[model samples]
Target chain A: MIAADGGLGIVATQRAVLTENGPLVLASGAQLPHVEVAYETYGALSPSRDNAVFVCHALTGDAHAAGWHEGARRPGWWDNLIGPGRAVDTDRYFVIAANLLGGCSGTTGPLSIDPATGRPYGADFPALDMADFVSAHRGLLDHLGVDRLHAAVGGSLGGMQVLEWALQEPDRIDRAVLVAASSRLTTENIAFSAVARAAILEDPDFRDGRYFEHGVTPRHGLKVARMMAHITYVSELSLAEKFGHRRDTAGHDKRLAADFEVEHYLQHQGESFLDRFDALSYLHLTRPMDYFDPFGAHQGVVPSTRFELISFDTDWRFPTAHSVRIRDQLAARGAAVEHAELTSPWGHDSFLLEPDGYHDRVRAFLS
Target chain B: MIAADGGLGIVATQRAVLTENGPLVLASGAQLPHVEVAYETYGALSPSRDNAVFVCHALTGDAHAAGWHEGARRPGWWDNLIGPGRAVDTDRYFVIAANLLGGCSGTTGPLSIDPATGRPYGADFPALDMADFVSAHRGLLDHLGVDRLHAAVGGSLGGMQVLEWALQEPDRIDRAVLVAASSRLTTENIAFSAVARAAILEDPDFRDGRYFEHGVTPRHGLKVARMMAHITYVSELSLAEKFGHRRDTAGHDKRLAADFEVEHYLQHQGESFLDRFDALSYLHLTRPMDYFDPFGAHQGVVPSTRFELISFDTDWRFPTAHSVRIRDQLAARGAAVEHAELTSPWGHDSFLLEPDGYHDRVRAFLS
Candidate 1:
């Protein structure tokens, strides 16, 4: 357990060897010789083992969905919606969040040492599928000895994971919540992710993803990609409200660098991101999202699980239309599904934020 | 005149040294020691000199506004709207199109030599403003010995230039048409440009904007920037209509490169841009647009030039709100102004395309 200052915002990430059977096979037929899952759990497991709830995180997020670390400045990414009495209500339900496959957090990813070569997988890491992420999550569940989950919840990429799992094991999850997710990435969405990947791959320092040998990383490329993604994550209105045309510099310094407040803010976001994220991880994780076509491939295999799909009005990344499409497809597949387009000034990041009627809706549904 | 084959599409670009008295003063209090303007003309000059219309080129455009150059496959940019019988109606009006001050074309830009150092201006190039573009344009007019114009027309950045010139020289232009333009860039807009600029500046080959001296340029950075900008230039609807989620590669290559048709399209845009555009010029030109707050600085000043502002319904970059703001500002200043939002599948690039009800509106206003 993380040493909590006042028994609040304290959580510890734990690890367990999950692949008991011979090499875990991916959706693409590739196999991982060994798999170690990193996960953080909140609250106690019910005596019936039926009160377990799983949480999936978006791109750039880790297993730390809620609670604060021993020396952290702020709570976990989704601390607002998954605490003692929050939407998920840790007091009554056992909640689990794991670092996804191809992630750079505690989970085994591209940065993990290959048992065969005794080296980081890096560029040699096999292609990932949405099903592969679900497979890893199941491994964690099997290790935890949870037969069934009361509910599963995720947003953005996390939501994609939740969707793939719910579809793969319809009988395991009784209820599922997918927020600001997509059944299929649009051409524009694919284009944005492609450019971000290109930025990292084309960086001179990338060195074919073996930058560890050179004691350097593709910091510039990764920073640029982060800055670009940040622009798309937030709505124009939110940015205008936050930064506007306000320049931080006095007079007309007129340098070609960050002069406007928004520029500096983006630069900070980009620079700070370099500390935690690996370029290879960014490429690997975002690629699966580009190719995620659940409804396309699983048209006939419909899930029996009930679903609540949520979207944000200002989310241009994966707007309400994306949820509506998911709803329609699930409805067409003879599945019971509910959808809501919530009002929010934030864009795609609205799921992580407590927008009007957002937390309340999630809370009411989860209960 | 350009030598024409079948007289179908032919035009020649011409050059003139415009500043006769002294060095041209920039809006930022800096001055260029020398100034030369590249211009192209269509239609015969009226004997009364009252039928001249000036066309301003947007970012990455040259003085080649219309007609085909010898051995070129495609006509000059804006060929649809400025031909002999198009919207501007070159047959009835003598049209003059000039490259902007910081452009990479025939006009003096960062690629131009700093007369003092006997080397390319590069990073040493003085700062630019919307007013500086207007000043250089005025010099072009002085050299042509044309005191007044029937109209001044431009779209996007070109539109911004037209608006600045109209305000600076109110009596000189009878009518001004601004298309998909912004008087002031929003924070989101500046953030985009800032990231684009950072890509070039941070590229290993940039060499502090003196990549020319190193016999290398920021090709990767500039290409990335162009690819990013192209995404904004078109609407998501148009991208969907044009490319959809069509995968171009055979089967599941599953590589991190361009898989979707839109990625290849964006890749082509980025690669082709490297052939014609200079990195320094890209930085210089885009910077001015970020700092373009004409209304903020020139609030007391108002133009008598009749204004016709056109915006595309789908232009998210500088949407109809931008044009509405321009109209409201001009109207508040007691100027005759008209605003219209035209339907177009294209986004910001709609101004350059023959969208429905667009050319007709401009032709009517110009005539």
Candidate 2:
């Protein structure tokens, strides 16, 4: 158990192994002999196990969703949303957060050892779809004896999972909150992800995802990938307001050193991301995000599950059009779906930035 | 002279050396002892030399604005708008297109030898500004015996030059056409350029812009930079229509290979750009673009040069707001200015793509 400031004081990320069914078959027809899921519980499971709220995370997020680790100065990525009396309100409901299937945060991913070769899976890790991620989450829920979830909520890539959960097993989730996400990746999304993957792969140290064995990381390539992705995460307005044409006070040296505030900010973001994330994991995870398409086969059908779709006006990544499309799809089938295109200059990251509007919507919908 | 199928049947790039001047003073407070300008001319100069139409090229453009070069498969970059009877009409006006001061083509730039060291300027090249570019063009005009220009026209960075031309020597230019560009770089422009520069600098091969001495090129870094910039050149709608989530027929290799069509397109753009552009020149040119702010010093005053502003609706790089701002500024100062917010899915490159509307407007104004 770990102590946090505002949220559940005690939180622990526990692991579950699913090995009873020989090997788990992935969407790509590959198999994992055994799967290990790392999950954190914010509160005690309800007596009936019906008041459980599952929180999924976006890319770079992990099971540490609401608390402070032993030596950590900052709380989890979504600590602002999940706390004692916050949006999710751990006091009334048991909250569960898990590291994704193709993730680096304590989850069995590319960095994990392969039983057959006694080496990190690396490039050998099977391609996984959103269904595989949901399946692994199901393994954890089944192990915890949770028959049904009160709600499944997430934003961005995490939100993709929330939609997948409702589509894959509607009865399992009573409600779903998908924020700043889309049912499928847009062309722009695929384009951006493609460039990012190229950056990592082109790095000399990458060695076809064998950088770990080479005793070096593809830090330069990964930094470039992060820098490219960071541009899409924030709105132009926000970027203009935050950085603008403002040069670093140090003055321009006419060299490679960052002269603009935005450049310095991007450099910092890229460098910091390398410390916590694995390059291979980023590649593995982003592929499924581009491949996710639950409505591909049933474009005209409306999902029966109740949904709350939220999008920020400034979010060009997953614009309001995506949320509106989902809302219209559900509404077409007479299903209950609420969508709000909230105005925020924070862009796609508005979900994590504006607490009042976003929290209120989540709280009201969840209640 | 080079033969061509359309427009002017024959054209050739000419060079002018400005050695008579002791040194060319730059906005950065540095000096270049000598400067050479590469320029191309179409049609004949009028007896009075007042029928000259000065054409400025964009970031990736060159002095070859119209007509074909010897053994070249394609015509000039602005061939569509500068042909015999086209918008600028080579038959009606003497068109002058000069490579920018810090450009890589045949112009004096980072690749030029520094007389003092007998080595390429590389990182040692003095920082330049828009005014420096205009100064070089002015020198070319003086050498050509052109006293005044009927019009100064350009799009994107070229448009920056057009604005600078009117601002620096208001009496020399009778009119200016600024298309899909602004008087200064926006915050987003600076941010994008910063990332591009960072990508080039971060590459190990860049060698602090001294890669030329090592007989190596920072192609990887330059490619990444081009890929990032290419995304901004087109609209999201255009990208979506041109290259959706359609994957390459060769199947995903689960590696860094281009899977999506957009990835393939960006890779091609990046690779092809490496053959024609220099990394140091890109760095040098993009800096002045960010630092360009002609209105900064003379905000309240608008020169008497006639102005034509064109912006595409989808050009988020230099949105209609930018053109409108310019229009408003010029109009408030009682300058003759015409602004058009045209609708086009091509984004910032619409000025170069939509020949009909853009050319018609230019033809009407210039005629």
Candidate 3:
């Protein structure tokens, strides 16, 4: 929450009980007894609450989507795209970004205490699906007395959640903007995630997700997992352009230090992630994306929700083909959808960055 | 060294002194007092010893390129590409396959005993370069009384060695075929290898590469490393075709069991690697490839050796672009060079299989 001495410019995080009811029933027939969502907002809500734009954060993201936090070194994660005079101008639209369900960033997730056992759910955390993620997102909106959404903008896994929320609440969402998202995961995609899961699950310190009580975490396995994932997040061209040929690697440096520039960059990414992310949260978030098959039955339709899907040219993670497929599926189901494959060297991470035309396109769609 | 049980029908593995000279000096200035190579020869060497063709192995490969090991369940790794009348026809040319230096498969590597201490070298094994691999390969040829090679063929890492050998000894090699090979590793390529190295090095059982005394190996790290590599070795399309979709995964299966079909396949690939590979050997072998820059100085030339570089359409590991670059380089250096981007359902592993028009192209090139 914004401190009592809250300043005018710096935005602090706020928490709210997502649901007014007792327990939230998940799509998997599981029940979350208590669900609290952490959120950050910018600008003012319209008198009718019709200008509320819900922004869904991607995997590993928190409610701090924009604006500088008090005493912080830098602004929020997407501070580049969502601020005053920015493409996602806070002056025009009231933006609401929340920590999604099954997240460790203040949302009631695996790290949250179980009311019955009075212990962190840990391995006992129930399985979650896209609908469950959407449910939590909508619950936060309900608590704020918002009846409809002006738009829902998300990227990567966040994009998946937006798609789910838009599809389920067709009439409530006017514009559903999905950036570098997938309607389903491919065998290769699952294979990559499987390796990450193996690294964490097989770690000796993991102790079967109950590592919290042991005062140690699966840092090694999680680090490897993050390093591998970071490689996929950025394109080959971007990595080369960012850090060109570094020839400092030793042939038999049994220690395997961060010899190459790219290795050093990846090592930092992996190391820093351990401080903010929980192994269980990672497992919870990524697994749902692997099994996400919204168009499996071709029943996913959103007639009232005009869809705007943007994909990066270099994004092999969820390539333009994935956007094309999503477009085709939505169009076939009689939903209005527009898609674009933008140029960027940052691969799957292009959506997060202000890649040339990316911000402009999103702004144009929002307006 | 082929045992008495070896019959005329089955080509059994044989061991020979790679170098008769005292301590073969390596490119890195490190010397090995005794070096032995495990090799297998198919067909007969013609008089004048001019019909000899060298076959180099890729990462995790060995001397068993073709034919069956006495009681083995399967033929060699590249059995389909070599044999009596396969593309690498053993009948027309005497095909010799040898495990490369720093290899764990019956070659003097990290697991080999040090002459001075009489203990496994482990981490003490000297560093290696492409030139060193070529030295060992040439030594094997000298032992067989073969002065010049009719051709040298390899895929992936093996293909890199062939390039180095052809450049160093242009006149000695008549033909050099490099399939799915890279002349130099890109930043992204090295990043992947770096993650693999991290997984193996940070393994608890690694013990600074002296795990031999502990009677334990870095199996967990090695398994994770292999799993990640296995994903890159195959294409997204191929993986999708092989394993469509099996969605039995539980989000919080905290155990991270092989619930998905692809997960099961990857798990099998990772687990099976531990049985045939060594951790230090994996680290040593992969690191050199990251630093291989034969064309960096641009003095590399192979005037007499006709070069044939083949790349698969789906092989993203070392895509057709890698072959095109190599082709342009060799052609500019006054060398006879040709390259083809072949169609294959498989990725980098396509070299070991008989894809449509693949075997025919090789046979015609060899003839």
Best by lDDT: 1
Q: Report the error of model 3 at residue A363, Å.
A: 1.3
Off by over 4 Å in 1: A1-9, A250-253, B1-8, B249-253
Clashes of 3: 0
Model 2 lDDT at residue A71 = 65
Q: Supply candidate 3's per-residue lDDT for B57.
A: 95
Model 2 chain A: ten consecutive residues of lowest lDDT: A248-257
DockQ score for model 1, please?
0.75
User: Lowest summed lDDT over 10 consecutive residues: which window, candidate 1 chain B?
Assistant: B1-10
**Model 3 C-alpha lDDT per residue in residues B1-367, reported as the tens digit of each score:** 2223232235688998765668878877788888999999987899778888899999999999887887887778887777777788777789899998989988789899888799988888887777888899988988888999999999999999999898888889999999999988989999999999999889888998899899888888999999999999998888999897764644433234567889999999999999989999898789778778788733845468998889999999999999998899899888999899999989988988877888887888888
Candidate 3 runs further than 4 Å off: A1-8, A249-256, A297-302, B1-8, B249-256, B297-302
Across residues B185-273, which tens digit of lDDT does each residue of candidate 2 receive?
66767777877887888888888888988999888788888888888888888999998877754332333367678888988998899
- Pull out the clashing pairs in model 2: none
Interface root-mean-square deviation (Å) of every model: 1.4, 2.7, 3.5
Tens-digit lDDT string for candidate 1 (B1-367): 3234322277889998866789998877898988899999888788899999999988988999888888888888888788666788877898999999888888999999999999989989987888888898889888887889999999999999999888787999999999999998888899999889889999999998888988998988999999999898999899999998888653345767678888889889999999999998898889989988777777777788999999998898998999999999999999999999988999999988888898899999998
Better-scoring candidate (DockQ), 1 or 3 = 1
Clashing residue pairs for model 3 = none
Provide the TM-score, chain A, model 1: 0.97
Task: Write down the lDDT of every candidate, Cα atoms only.
Answer: 0.88, 0.84, 0.86
